[model samples]
Target chain A: MIILHHLNNSRSQRILWMLEELELPYEIKRYERDSKTMLAPPSLRQVHPLGKSPIISDGEVTMAESGAIIEYLGQKYGDGRLIPETGSADYRQYIYWMHYAEGSLMPPLLLRLVFEAIKSKPLPFFIKPVARKIADETTRQFIAPQIKTHFDYVEKFLGEHEWMAGHKLTGADIQMSFPLEASVARGVADSYPNITAYVKRFQERPAYQRALQAGGDYDYA
Target chain B: MIILHHLNNSRSQRILWMLEELELPYEIKRYERDSKTMLAPPSLRQVHPLGKSPIISDGEVTMAESGAIIEYLGQKYGDGRLIPETGSADYRQYIYWMHYAEGSLMPPLLLRLVFEAIKSKPLPFFIKPVARKIADETTRQFIAPQIKTHFDYVEKFLGEHEWMAGHKLTGADIQMSFPLEASVARGVADSYPNITAYVKRFQERPAYQRALQAGGDYDYA
Candidate 1:
């Protein structure tokens, strides 16, 4: 059986959802964040060196990185589901989103989170305003605009195609779900109707709902 | 013809390297970053919506994201080169590094660049110290440590395997070349002999050298 070394409130939740979508029999080995630091527990490193969440082990194969895991499982067990036929335009889009989710999209969103934390985290009163200013300026000047550009690009794409890879739901959408969900949850994507509806449409899936149950305490959902 | 919408000092340089590795005929349409802002030229959006570097157009297909472009070329043109066979452990490693390069690795490195910029950028005299403090603390506390963790992880991995995907040099190494090069060029990996050697090993490749000539002004190389 495959074991997802799951971590709370991380990308692993989406992996769980993917497994559910494949209807694969799997087990979840839950790991929680350090409540204070919000970092993945050190024990998680045993699975993969960097200790990032969503590491999965099946027999001798242990993998980290959501895109790799998704592609691995899709190839191994998907049986023509959740994957576009290779060489099609949809396949190209699938590969693009698979990389773009973490490569392009998540970085800015992660920066937004880091900067927001900088704004709110308690600091010496003298330094507080300066820190807030720095965070605000960085967000306003750098992070926010980039995020808007990406969200706008995605919103327009979703408007044209029902799914990230096209009309049919593919692993690209599964790969894309977390970042878009986080966008919706953070209120940054409130104006993006297509994105919000995309999130809602996926969340309403019985498989997604089941994955939520199997996983626990996901704030983004 | 595969026309790489090349951008100076950006990820597209690796796409050029991949093209050379495959010995494919390709054209480079160069875009330079803004001298002051250091962002990709606005005109790149003509090729892809995100306007990010490394967009490529071959006939009807126009694609963005380095991993996608590399995979597309490897599958369509590689003809049993760079990519590993399906279901093999080497293939798994290839996928991991493909995603890990941009997905797992680049974000913190990017944050380091942003914070480093924050430290050095001209600011109001009164606010300079506090801004520096914020940048320093963030780097010391978050960005630097994360980068270290990753570099160390990679160093250990490289110690065990000659290439990212095992004994053979694969597309994973090409996918990984830029950030590792950036790490070395920035002097962070001066102490990481394996990484430095890894970068050096690939840089000396005839294809990589050819790529440098074709794609001008790549700082990381």
Candidate 2:
């Protein structure tokens, strides 16, 4: 049996959604991140040296990264189901979105969270302005365009189509679902009406509900 | 026929090496990074809105992002030659390394670059102390581990095995080749005898020679 180590309000929820969509039998081990730091607990490092959430220990194979996890699960569990074979056009696009979610997308999300942390904290006066400036530049290079251009692209994508890819509901949508939700959780997309409506649509699906329930900790705020 | 819009000493060289590994025919439209700022050439935007490296135009399909490009090439040109089939264990490991190269490894590289930039830049005396502190902390979180822990893992693995997976060459090795080379270029791994030897092994390959020749600005120093 596959054992998914899950955490609330983390990318791990996407894994649960994926497992649910595939109807794959799996066990969930819940992990709650600390309230203040919002980091996956240190105990996680024992599971994998990376100490990240949404990891899986399937018999002998222990893979950690979420993008890797989704790709692995899609291959191992959803062979005839969630993911299309590599030869298909959708598979090509699927890999793009799968990598894009983390590679192209998450760096800015991480920088934003770090900037927010610096802002919220009572810091020594000497370094705060420099920190803010670096954060601003990071925003210019990665964050601003990501939300404006990429989010607009996603909104346009969700506008004409119900899913991220083809007519079938594949893991790509589930792969992207949490980050879009986190953008909401972070107030990053407060003004994008299409995305707001799209998130609502995603929330209405029973599979989404089942995914959250199975995940054990995801609150979907 | 494929057209690769490439820049010298950039991540695009990885794409070049993979093309050599597959012996795929291609043309390179080269651009030099601006001497003043050392940024990727402005011509990149013409390839994609994001203005990134390793954008390939195969007929009408234009793709950006390095990992996506490698996977695309593997599926489209090499078929099951460079990467494994989608459901195989080799395929799963291939996907992990694909994500690992960018998701886990590259961020530290860029972060370390950022710190070096902050340190070496001409700045006011008042700001240097705080700047040093920030650089030190960021380096702790993002930079130091890639060389010490990450490359150590790579060093040991290469010592124990002939390739990244099984006994055969795959795209994962191709993906890893650039980073290991880059780490050497960055002076990150002298202490690890095995990684140093592995780097020498990969660098001496005929395909690597072809890639360096095709690249024109062969600065894989």
Candidate 3:
């Protein structure tokens, strides 16, 4: 039996969504983030050394990294539905979006989160303004611009195709779901209708709704 | 003909290495990073909207993201040499490493670089120490520990397997090359002999040498 090591409100939600979409039988071993730290609890380290979510164990095989898990499920259980045919143009785009979601898109979004957290941390009266200035300047000069570029690129792509890869729903969409959801939560998605619309379409799917029921509260959507 | 849109000392070097390993004929259109901004030149934006290095074009297909590019090359040109056989445990491990390299590993390394840059930038005498404190605290509290965890995890994996995916030098190693190289350049690889040794093994390969000769100056080695 396949067992997903899921964490609340984390990237693990996408795995649950993919599992639902594939109609696979899997058990979720739910983990909660620490209330104060907002980090995956230390107990999760028992499942995967990285203590990361969306990890799954099928018999003896234990895997981490959402893209890898998504690809694995698509290959082993997908019956050729989640991925495009090998050597096709859609296959290339499929590969690009799957990797791009985490490799390119998530990094800046993560940095933005970190900067915001840093900005909010209580500081001495004298140091507060300096800290805020650094955070704001970094956002303006570095973080925000990169996020905008990525969103712009995605918007342009979605404008052309209904889905990330091409005309069909594939693992690319599942892999991309979390980052885009987080973007919507950040309010950046308001300016990019294509992205917001894509997220809305995803939310409207019955399988996605089922995943939401299986997985716990995810406020990003 | 396959064209690699390479930038000096960037992730694109891995594509050249993979091309050499596969013995595929490919041309390079090299772009230089801006000296001051340290960002990819605008010329590359024409090739891919993200303007990131390691974008490759074969005929009409233009692709970005190193993991995706590595997989494409492995699938289309590998002749079953660089990637493990499908449905095998090694193949699963192969996919995990390919995605983990960029998805899990590179982000912290990139943030460390950015933080270091922020720490070094000229600032007003009064604000200099405050900026340094924030950078230092972030590194100590957040960045360095995560990096150590990643390095420890990699060291353990290399201790068990000669290559990233079992015993063979698959594209997993190619995908992982840049981050490990950056680790060495950061002076962090010394404590992790397995990582340093793995990198040494990689650097000693004739294909890697050929890639260096063709791709020009790479200081990480």
The C-alpha lDDT values of all candidates are 0.91, 0.75, 0.91
Backbone clashes under 3 angstroms, per model = 0, 0, 0
The per-residue C-alpha lDDT of model 3 at residue B193 equals 92
lDDT of 3 by residue, B1-221 (tens): 99999999888899999999999998999998888887899998999888999999899788889999999889988888999999999999999999999899988888888789889988899998999999999989999999999999999988988998877799999999999987887697889999999999999999999999999988776
- Model 3 regions more than 4 Å off: none
True contacts kept of each: 0.88, 0.51, 0.92
RMSD of each: 0.9, 2.8, 1.0
> Model 3: share of native contacts present?
0.92
Query: Candidate 1 vs candidate 2: which has greater lDDT?
Result: 1
Per-residue lDDT of A1-221 in model 1, one digit per residue for the tens? 99999999999998999999999999999998989999998998888888889999999888899999999999999999999998888899999999999998999999988899889989999989888888899899999999999999999988888888867788999999999998899898999999999999999998999999999899998
Can you tell me the CAPRI class of model 1? high
**Please, what are the lDDT tens digits per residue for candidate 2 over residues B1-221?**
89888988887888898999888988898888888777777678778766667789998788777888888898778866887776567677777778877777776666676667777767688877776777777678646864466766667677888877556778887777776777786677778778777778878889988888888775554
| Least well predicted 10-residue stretch by lDDT in candidate 3 chain A | A159-168
lDDT of 1 by residue, B169-214 (tens): 7899999998999989989999899999889999999999999998
lDDT of 2 by residue, A1-221 (tens): 88988777777888778777777788988788899867778787788767667888889888877788987887777766767676577776777777777776666666566556645556588678876776566567655765576687677777787766666767777767767887876678788777777777776788788986676655554
- Model 2: residues >4 Å from true position, as ranges? A34-38, A137-149, A152-161, A216-221, B141-149, B218-220
Q: Return whichever of 1 and 2 wins on DockQ.
A: 1
